[model samples]
Target: MTTKNLLVELFVEELPPKALKKLGDAFAGTLADQLKALGLAGADSVVTAYASPRRLAAHVTHVWLKAADKAVQQKLMPVTVGLDASGNATPALLKKLQALGADVSNPAAAVAALKRAPDGKAEALFYDSLVTGATLDTGLQKALEEAIAKLPIPKVMSYQLETDCELPGWSSVNFVRPAHGLVALHGSTVVPVKALGLTAGNSTQGHRFEAKVAKVVIKDADSYAATLQQDGAVIASFAERRAEIARQLAAAAAQVGNGVRPIEDDALLDEVTALVERPNVLVCEFEKQFLDVPQECLILTMKANQKYFPLLDATGKLTHQFLVVSNISPSDASAVIGGNERVVRPRLADAKFFFDQDRKKTLESRVEGLGKVVYHNKLGTQGERVERVRAIARAIAQQLGGEALAKAADTAARLAKTDLLTDMVGEFPELQGIMGGYYARHDGLGDEVANAIEDHYKPRFAGDDLPRNNVGLVVALADKLETLVGMFGIGNLPTGDKDPFALRRHALGVIRMLAEKDLPLDLNALLAGAVPAFGDKINDATPALAEFIYDRLAGSLREQGYSAQEVEAVLALQPQRLGDVTKRLAAVRAFAALPEAAALAAANKRISNILKKAGDVDAHVSDVLLKEQAEKDLYAALKSVVPQANAQFEAGDYTASLQTLAALRAPVDAFFDDVMVNAEELDLRLNRQGLLKSLHDAMNRVADLSRLAA
Candidate 1:
């Protein structure tokens, strides 16, 4: 039962930086999980993952040398079938025992060893045996293979390796990259395992250029990371390397005072970390004249094309300097800095040129050019789409504001997509809306219009900010609604994860603007209003689109910490004004906390079922038909409570409204307890049904409380 730590590593060519973290995590997690499942690793075992530009490794502590033996009980056959009337062993039973590796030389003794147990309706014969555990070699091999098979490789490269035997031949191997070496050590002992057409060993190569030694020898599982770092001159752990790079970047930025710092982007940092084995952060700069270009353009070019981090001053404006993460460290770093500056000069020059050339043409002039650019085959060109958005924006602004706001929204929506025709946006599509804002300003348009054009695509992703101003809000809503209605109209709705048009995102954006801004707009009316802009190009998808938006709203509310019961109850009403949804949810929660919530909810559920079965029963109940004392009492309670609840509901005091309805719990309970809804007389049954129908209507005005019933 002795145990020791295990270490495994795979050295290969450079891996895709974008997928490096995912691959490393999957490799270590799957390998350790397999070992635990196979009983080769204990519950307290700790696993550490190591990844670099050229290697992926894992270290696991407390792994057993061999799994423990397990006791197994297997059912043979029914006693009636396996044994005969004479109480003697049958030929079939003897054959079955022999196949299970049981001694059959004395059939009677074998039969005596089998135990009889009651199974279902009859007795069955069961065989007990001890199954041997797997050794470390076999277990690790299986775990290694399973881990390799589960790697989330972006792409697999196929290469040929020379055969190990005395034959002059090659074998093809498919992996993330070409495998050069593998190390597997169990407490300093080399474990015999093979993978990717290579046998495991204790040696691996590191830092293709800066290694102090040609080969790094991992002495033991405990010293894997330290040994690799000292001998190979590489930081094996991806997290440690990323932290080192971050620390170096901070030091360099602080050295160049004036509150200068590198731009913050985790994805860029991860990619840079994956591109280097040993990180050496160095400061480099382009010409100061490049600052005349918009900082977004310059930053995008540096990060996207050169994989560089552009520095920004305290004002969040791009500076002339940037940071570069070098894989190799040298004493004379001046040469490296100069080389990087020289390499990035041409890139910044290109961005400056595009920005200068783009401002020459006005966004107004670019409007005519969008007519040739196709948006969707079914939907017309960008020019036509712009008109539709303008129409929708105008209508929304009129409802939100007057003709003044509508006029501004119409201009912003018309020119929003004109950025797609600009040279700067064409080269860097990420800067479409951003560049539009800049160009609109150059056209002498007010910040209101320019900002709206830029922020029309705001809240692009999750947690992104919504529109800044009212005009921007109108345009953003119009822009998203146009896409949603257009796509859902043409049957281009998103399926599962395939959101080709980003309909889900568009729908969410619309919901966020409506709910967050607390706009006094109706969801159904908004969707209906946008349909006329499409003319003959779309079908009436309002009903389906409403359901889709409500579904997104429900999921979003749940993620915001509202329980499923609260969300379902409020969203069940499909409130026309999404702005009131959160208010109603708060009310429902407060009402659920009331002492009578459960009883009222249960009674409400019962009343709903009765009304449904009593089909077409009016809510009008004649006091003369109230023959039962319980019915009279319930009707009197409704008369006292309904007026107050309805007044609170009209005044937007939903919590008070629901709480007022809680007063009917006792009377509702008595009505159901003392009276049968389906009485023998037709008139009596109809009157009882009418009373229940009235109760159901009043209770469900805020939410479907029946959903709260267990």
Candidate 2:
């Protein structure tokens, strides 16, 4: 009846950001699951956890003071699953033995697998037999360790006392950090920690160098965590840390008077949390002359280089002041401010030199240098990629605009990556296409070219924005296509989280841009169109690469909740545009929500059940042999809807097309209900079969209704 909280904090050396979140989730989930198997979980109770770069902790709440009594069964549940071709329990339980992959051909071999006790008094089969008893808590702990051992922590480590237990491969258990300790607590008492050689304890430490070891005794689980904080550790709740940082940031910015703001980087905030213990925001000022540099450069220089939050005016203009977050509180505030400014100056100087040097050379002159930067080991250079981009962009642009803009788009694609050779982009690699646009415009190139140059890498991440202009969409896709095709050629495709080339993101970006940009080009044709423009040799045919593109596209769409059948339904028609495919799938998804779609799905299933026995349903329907009135009615209903469905398809009103095809469902059910398809007369039987065939084709115009969910 009584409960207590449980706390576990793993104090380790700094963990990589790459694996910190995953390790935290594993610790939380494994701990909760372990307790649940022990019959210790409370109703609706959640396991809470967090990680700093240095630590990972899990707190199990409403945990029973003692694990509840659990009935454990050692026997695996067995049931009749299938049968041998000749029906019998035969020598074996036919169904059970078939499911076990036993040789059904030799019935006696299957019979031998059945449980025959050592005493020769086998009471029952394995399915019916049961073990008398088992312990729950011990089993739970074993299962927990097995599952946690598989959780991915990319930077693996071993912690045994070969003391520096860090090895390249499996000598001991690998973890994100040294996995210094694992604290397992069950209510107020220590859970067994022999697995990780740790014990739940009352003592905790703080800020390794700054603060001394602090001791506090915990009466129960609640006090266990509360006591850790009382001993000077923040305990690092991500949600709390985020809120605290936001609140402190808002208050600090307000103190700057006219205008100030925190930078919009969740990523940097995560890193900053790892860099500090008790985060304190300190406002500092740099020389206003730094503001004379372009505002974009100043912000990047401050935020990325120094990790200093940039201060912006009310109108979003850059100000000379910045906010620095420090871990320790010191009396000499200005001295710390001077230290950050000193670190930031060289980065600011680099940006200034890049700006001055790049302005002198027109975007046109930078093309020669692109050849020196190899695009891939086999795929020539960036200069060659631009040439291929020009050809591909020209063809794609035709779908976006008239000849003039298409020509302008091709011209823009030709020069987009020229800025990669520029001094500014060389120092700031993140600003590759970005600097191209800036330089192109300042050198008097038209706006379209500049837009295309910058927009080529839009939708860089899943939640990132897509390119706004048609010119950008064309080049962006051309770039991703080259990467996808070229990588597939060189055998560097992603496998086992080894996407060093970022091909998945590139594929997703292509899919998102095409669907959201409303471009009306055939993707299959586009893939075919671009593959020849690749490296001099063709390792894979255009068709094979097109199919490859579709696989990635399907994977990308499936992640958005489209089922494999739904993707196939849309993809089968070879949709002319991604927007068209998305629209068709959306209509199917929406119609799937209606009870009528379910009704239609059920009716289609009945039709499939009756006709799927035959070779193919694409057979011709015979009008001459209709016998039953229901048969005549159904045939007429299907023929009448064909034109209506085609009209809706032409107008791209898929909802209307589905509705039009659904008109045959009533007549279809009537025929199936009243008329026997395999009648005494062979002519009528064939006629009725033909009628169902027509129904299959008509409904498929909307989507294969047979594939939709009932």
Cα deviation at 644, candidate 1, in Å, is 1.4
Writing each residue's lDDT as its tens digit, candidate 1 over 1-710 gives 78999999999999999999998999999999999998999889999999998999999999988899999899999888888898667888888888999998987788888999999989999999988888889999999999999999988889998887897999999999998888998999999999999899999987888888997888999999898889998999999999999999999999988999999999999999999999999999888998999999999999999899899999998999999999989999999999999999998898889989988989999899989999999999999999999999999999999999999999999999999998888899999899999999999998999999999998899999998899999999999999999998998888888998888889889999999999999999999999999999999998999999999999999999999999998999999888899999999999999999999999888887877777787998999999989999999999999999999999989999999999999999999889988999999888889899889989999999988888
Candidate 1 deviant stretches above 4 angstroms? 87-98
Clashes found in each candidate (C-alpha, N, C closer than 3 A): 0, 2
**All candidates: TM-score:** 0.97, 0.77
Candidate 2 stretches with Cα past 4 Å from truth are 1-10, 13-25, 28-202, 208-238, 292-296, 314-317, 488-492, 540-574, 589-632, 670-695
RMSD of each: 1.5, 8.4
Please tell me which predicted candidate would have the highest TM-score against the true structure: 1
Pairs with backbone N, CA or C atoms under 3 Å apart (clashes), candidate 2:
5-221, 82-95
Distance from true location, Cα of 327 in model 1, Å: 1.1
Worst 10 residues of 2 by lDDT: 73-82
